[model samples]
Target: MTMRIVAGIVISAVVGVALAVTASYALATSNAPDREVEDAITTGNLRAGVVVEYGTR
Candidate 1:
């Protein structure tokens, strides 16, 4: 019984670590825009009062 509980705790910890690593990797390699694109959007918005949604574009 104690061994089973310890094994469960170890398995849960390993899974948690794996999930955390995967999440970190996903966030690190996300599809966020670069500086030029952001600058262009900002410029357009400032020049023409346009509202550009990044996700839509």
Candidate 2:
């Protein structure tokens, strides 16, 4: 349905933004420019749980 498609798009976009911000925060805090992000932390399952994990900053 159109509503479902729109919701999916919105959710995907939001997740993408969250991934970017979290990655940036981790990158900034770690102070390791040479190290890749995947080596820093896994950005999977952007739920309330993961949000709490990333909320330390």
Candidate 3:
């Protein structure tokens, strides 16, 4: 049905936007090399799970 087709298209578009945003965030964060150290020390915790895994500034 036409409604089904329209719903499918909307779903695809939403998925595409999510993927693009994630990709952009990854790219932006990829520039920093000492991200883990910086984040851990700043937050006063050495736990691997405590630091933000992203490479962003």
Alpha carbon lDDT of each predicted model: 0.83, 0.72, 0.82
Off by over 4 Å in 1: 32-57
- What order do candidates take by lDDT, descending? 1, 3, 2
Regions of candidate 3 where Cα sits further than 4 Å from its true position: 36-57
lDDT of 2: 0.72
- RMSD in angstroms between candidate 1 and the native structure over all alpha carbons: 6.1
Residue-level lDDT of model 1, residues 16-35, one tens digit each, is 99999999988986877886
Residues 3-52 of candidate 3 have per-residue lDDT tens digits of 99999999999999999999999998898668567866896876565544
Shift of residue 38 alpha carbon in model 1, Å: 16
| Residues forming the 10-long window of minimal summed lDDT in candidate 3 | 47-56
Counting clashing residue pairs in each candidate, in order, gives 0, 0, 2
